[model samples]
Target chain A: MTVILNQSFTGVSIGAVLLLIALGLTLTFGQMGVINMAHGEFIMAGAYTTYVLQKPIGDAGVSLLLALPVAFLVAGSMGALLEWLLIRRLYTRPLDTLLVTWGVSLMLQQLARDIFGAPNVQTTAPGLLTGSVSVAGVNLATSRLFILGFALLCVAGLAAILRTTPLGRRIRAVVQNRDLAEVSGIATGRVDRTTFFIGSGLAGMAGVALTLIGPIGPTTGTNYIVDAFLVVVVGGIGRLRGAVITAFVLGLLQSVLEYSTTVSVAKVVVLVGIVAFLQWRPQGLYTVRTRSLV
Target chain B: MTTTSTPPTAAPATEPPAGPPETPFLGRFLGRFRTPAAFLLGAVLLVGVAPLVLSDFRLGLLAKYLCYGIVAVGVSLAWGRGGLLVLGQGVFFGLGGYAMAMHLKLADAAATGETLPDFMLLYGTEGGLPWWWQPFANPAFALAMTVVLPMAVAALLGALVFRRRVKGAYFAILSQALAAALAIWLVGQQATTGGTNGLTGFQGFFGYDLNDPINQRMVYVVIAVALLLLMAAARQLFVSRYGELLIAVRDSEERVRFLGYNPANVKLVAYVVAAGMAGLAGALFVPAVGIISPALIGIVPSIGFVIGAAVGGRASLVGAVLGAIAVAWAQSTLSDAWPAGWTYLQGLLFVVAVGFLPGGLASLRTVLRRRRTSSDRVGATKGVTT
Candidate 1:
């Protein structure tokens, strides 16, 4: 029973990271209909930002805290720039966006490798997040618990922003009806840029969280990209809450499966399951109701 | 209802170029075969003329490029013409390549009268050959399996995916996932698959000594011939009614469906055919390249399979072939010059092509002509495209 609870905790920790990554994807891909294959690279950039800052800041706790906004700013600005230069022109061409972003991903990966010396780098977790705490016969790493709390905080913060902020309202308006939003005097393009910024900033923060759990590498983001994409897809297009729920569901399922089978086999099983799920429910767990006919 | 008034304008727009033209029977027949004839000339030059001028080593490299050209031809049919954007031709290529490699390995073991192949001895039990690999001991069976395996898998996958109406980015991602899964599977099954090292160290192919330069040249000839034949077949398919239906499906799936045609089945056929061609290319690639590994079946290489088609012109058959050869040649030469920089260049090329040159190199002529007649810019931009 304790082991099961521990595994579930681990799953939730993984799910928290997944939620951060998928939130960005859900907004850019699910809501805006742009396939940003380079999103993973943005995460890589965030981790690298933390890695570079570790030297100047010196103290792990302070540096770790400082990395979050710096990483977000770096990745978010890059995302915004990419949206302006490439994605802006390819709005009507979704598949073309996919290819172009894939190209961008390759270039970014190569850039990371060249700059980072083609090896993984370790990032030290703050002393506050180093130990473990036991609850109900289950011993949980303090870092994992911190990640869970941070993820929840992010979720709540994002929800509040979407609910209260003018920019968020504009984003929602544009997603629902672009032409209508434009006519209603909302700056649709600015909303797109802001959405991309926040989405990519969340991914950068996920990368920061990732460094606490494991080593950072140029290709580290890619290892999680497929799962993140699946989370967004299984959750449903344009549904943020659905993304959060599905990310945890998938994370737990994978963790439980890994206990029973080899990790590779577990992955294959999860992928197959997602493929089957897609076959059964092509619109995913949730879908926006659009009145226009094809 | 919105399309009710479109036919009158669309019909005149599309019909005038061929509506009233008449030509002599011989001229019409020759015109129909013009592209194929030029392709034949190109093949002859590649196969016959190159051998005399280039050294054996250069010829072998060209042969490998030709193998890529074969796969690119399939990519052209699927992505260029059918608008499927199949991002996982590597799965079919790997399947076919492995099938042939398994047979060659088994053949090598049989030649030594051993019960199990060398890698199996280390990882797998020493009892006997595995039940699955037993069929591949025969040369003909292996060759047949190469074509059949990809065709069967592609047909099944295409049927399932298309039936679910999974397409666009969804289809692309799903296909990429399958390739990743396949690569991981291959890597994990080290005992049976030779793992990451992949199936290599072949001495002979169907009793021909690989050490001899003559046999190597023979392999190149075989590849050239196979490419020519596949190109001819693709050309025929492109000019057929099926091809027209494919274009209709691409341009407007709803209209095609309303016309009482099943777009899914049409796409399935094209996909299966493309898979079969890729498998054949992979089969030849094994002997020519002397190796097949999980590295070639991953997402990167899978993307590489179609990148050539995208750069050359996905819609043009000859363009795909030329693009594949040119890209492969560039990779080899560029990497030789600057080992680490080639990938960056390739990635930049891909981005530039997809972003600014959607029609690829084949459309250069039309683009230039449009530049000459600036008034046609709007019409050119509004041309039917994916």
Candidate 2:
């Protein structure tokens, strides 16, 4: 029973991480038709950013806090530059965008390897969240629980901004109908740039969040990107709620299966199962509005 | 075909002043040598003579290129003609390669009289071969499964995704994510799937000594024949009615649907065929290369397949085969020359190809023809005074 509880806790923590990583991809894919295959590289950038900032801040707590915005800025700027220099030209040609972004991803991965070497960098969790908590005879890692809460807070914050802010309104408008929104005096080009920045920034934040739980490495992002993409797809295009639900469900399924079977088999089974499921519901768990005003 | 005459406005250029000079037989034949049939003949000659001209090592390398060409043809069918952008061909390729590799590994183990592979013993796997892996001990079963399994998976995937109308980048991303997941899963399953080390150290293929020059040459011949057959098959499909509909779906899915045809079915058929071709290529790759690892079937390699197809002229069947072979050859030569710099050179090639030659080398003739005609017209206009 205790083992079950522990597994569930771990599953939730993993789900939280998956949610964070996938959020950016969801936004980018939803707003701009570009798949942004380099989104994983952005996560790597954030991880590296966190790793670099760790020494300057000294205190673990302060360093973690400082790494958050810095990662956002660094990754966001890089994403913006990629959009300006390469991605913008490939619009409407999604496959071309995918191939180009893949090239960019390779370049970023090689750059990271060159700069940081191939070794995994160590990171420390804050003392406040590092220890375990005993709850109902189940000892759960405090850091993981904090991460789950932090992820929820981030999601909620983003949701609120999307619902309440004028900029959010503009983004939603463009997502719904780019031509119509453009004709309505919305500068869609500006919105596209800003959306890409915010999406990439979120990926960076996810990276910082990841270091609190485990080690950072050049290829660490590759580990999570697949799961993130699965979550985004299962959640449905352009739907935040779908991503969250799918992430949690997949996370729980994977954890439970890992407990019952080997991790590798569990993963293969889950992937096969998801592929089958997507065949049934290719639009994903939810279908966004499809009324093309243009 | 339409029998409409050329427009009067376009006729002025074709009309000669009094009588146009007839081209000599030699000139006409020389010009005819540039035709598609001539190109096909030249290509066959070049490939056939390469083995005799190049060293044994280079022949083996070319054989590897042929294997990639087989897979590239499949990629072109699905991505170039069908517009599926399947970014997960690696998963199918890996499946086929691993299937063949497992059989070879088992055969080697049996010959050595070992209960388990050396790596398995080192990893402390005391148990006998896993139940699922037992079927692969039979060489014939392994080969059959290698071809069937990937096709089955692809068919299932196509039926599901296409039925739900998941086209464009969504489908591409989904497939790529699947490839990435499969690679990681293979890497993580150390005991059963051989983990990151993958399946290697095969000594023979069905009682034939793989290291013998005769066997090596036989492998090369098999690869060449298979590639030629696959390309011929792809060309036939391109000219068929089904092929026309496939391209139609790609250009306008809704329009195709309105024309009393199921676009999804058309795309699905092409997708399955492509997957089957990829699987066959992969099965052949194992015997030719004598190794199959997770590294080869990962996201990067899958993208490499797409890059080759794109660079070769995805729409042109011959271009698909030639482009894949050329890219593989370049990669081998570049890696041999400068291991570290090959990746940068590859990137530059992709950038230049995408920017300047969207139609790839296959369209080079068309571009040249356009230029030649333009220049000839310019000369004709200037010669009016003469």
Candidate 3:
């Protein structure tokens, strides 16, 4: 029973990480229909930001906390730059955008390798995160609990921004109908850059959380990119509620399967499951009804 | 059929399927002489000139390039003309490669009077040859399995994906996921699949000694011939009526559906054929390179395949084939000089090709021609078009 409870908690924690990683992708891919393969690199950038900041700052927890917003700005600016430079030119061609972004991803990975060297880097978390706090006889690691709480906080913050703010309203307007939004005097281009920024910033934040758990390297982002994309895909294009639900479901499914099977087998099964599931619900968990035809 | 045999290279390698619905003036002017001319050029370069000019080691390298070129031919058909960005070709290549490697390993073990391959012994021959590896012992069965397995997987996957009308970027992501999954699974199966190092170290291919220069040359010739045959087949597909239907589907699927045709089936054929080609390449790659590892059949390698096709012009048969060879050749040479440089260069090439030169090197002529003809409009189209 303890094992089951622990495993379930593990599943939820995994879901939170997955959600954190995928939130940016969901926003960018959903809003612009641009597949930013470099989003993973943004996560890597966030992680590296954490690592870099730990050098000068004596307080591990202070640097870690400070790293979140700093990582966001760094990754967001990079994303905005990408949107302005390359992605904006290929807006009419989504397939081209994918390839170009993949190219960008490769360069960014190389850049990271050159800067950080090929070896994996890790940052020290404050004692607050590193230590475990027992609850309900589960004895959960505080790092994981921190990650889960942070993920929820980010999601809540995103929801508030999207639902309440004028920029959020503008983003939603552009997402629904770009031409209409443009005619209504909304600067779709600026919105796209902002959306990319926030989305990529979230990925960076996810990266910082990742440093608490494990070592990170140039290729770290590549490892999670596909999984994040899968989460976004299953969550259905741009719907946050759907992304939230799908992340947990996928996380739980992967966790339960991993308990019984090997990690590789678990992954393969999950992939096959996603493929099969997509066949049934090609649009994913949720989709906005529209009369618009491509 | 004869009409379809017109030199596709002369025609810019796009549109009209079997025969141009309206033969562009360039194709018409080049029509009669160009087909035979192109065929003669291929024959002379590959069969006559290459063998005489290049040494055995260089020839072997060229053979490896040709193997990649074979995969690129299929990528062109599916991605270029059909507009199906197939990003996960590595899965099929891996499938074919492992199939061949299994047979080679088994053959080596049998020759040495061992019950299992060396890796099996190292990892654990405990369960005796897993039931799956048992059949690959037969040479013919292994060869057939190489092409068949990848094609079968592609057919299944393509059917599922295309039928539901899931395409564009979504399809690319799903395909990439398959490559990642397969790589992870292979890595985990340390005992059965040879794990990370993958299946390597072959003494012989069929009965020929791998170390013998003569036999090595034979392998190169086989790869070259195989690539040519496949390129011809792809060209045939491009000119066939079905090719036109594929382009139609790509350009406007709804219209194709309205015309009482299943867009899924058209896509399935190209995808399956492309998989078969990659599988063959993987099989041949085992003999030429003496290795088939997860590293070579992962997301990066899959992207490498598409990058080659993109560089050459996915829509052009000849261009894709040449592009794959050029990219492979560049990797072998450039990486040796500067290990880190190749990755950046490759990315740069991919971005430039996809963003600026979507039609690839094959379309350069068209772009230049258009620029000259419309000279009055200065700097128009920035000297290119999608």
Report the number of clashing residue pairs per model.
1, 1, 2
Q: List where candidate 1 sits over 4 angstroms from the true fold.
A: B1-33, B124-127, B375-386
lDDT of 3: 0.87
What residue pairs clash in candidate 3, if any at all? B17-B239, B18-B239
Q: How well does each candidate superpose onto the true structure, as a TM-score?
A: 0.93, 0.88, 0.95
True contacts kept of 2: 0.26
lDDT tens string, model 3, B1-386? 11101111222336323554598888887886786689778977897789889998899899889989989988998888778889899999999999999999999999999989999999776879999999999999999999999999999999998888778777889999999999999999999999999999999889988989889888888888888788777778888899899888777777788899998999999999999999999999998988999999999999999999889888888888889999999999999998789999998987899887778898887767665767877656551345
Better of 2 and 3 by lDDT: 3
For model 2 chain B, the run of ten residues with the poorest summed lDDT? B1-10
Please provide, for model 1 over B1-386, each residue's C-alpha lDDT reduced to its tens digit, 9 standing for 90 to 100: 11111111111011112422588888888878877688778877978898888889999999999999999989888777777878889999999999999998888887888778877887866557778999999888999999999999899888888887777677778787878888888888788888899998877899887878999999999999999889988888988999888877766676888899998999999899999988998899998989999998888888888888778877788888899899999989998998568878888878887766667788766656556666655555554332
Q: For residues A11-109, could you state the per-residue lDDT of candidate 3 as single tens digits?
A: 888899999999999888888888899999999999999999999997999999899999999999999999999988877677778889999999999
lDDT string for model 2 (A1-294, tens) is 888988898788889999998888888877776778789889999988888887877788888889999999999999999888877765645566667777777778767887888789987778988889899888888878877887898789888878899988998887777778989999988998998999999999988888878888878887787788778778876778998899888889889999998787788788878877877786679756664310
Model 3: DockQ score = 0.50
By DockQ, is 1 or 2 better? 1
What clash count does candidate 3 reach?
2
Q: How does chain B score by TM in each prediction?
A: 0.89, 0.85, 0.91
User: Considering only the true interface residues, what is the Cα RMSD of candidate 1 after superposition?
Assistant: 6.3
RMSD of each: 3.9, 7.0, 4.8
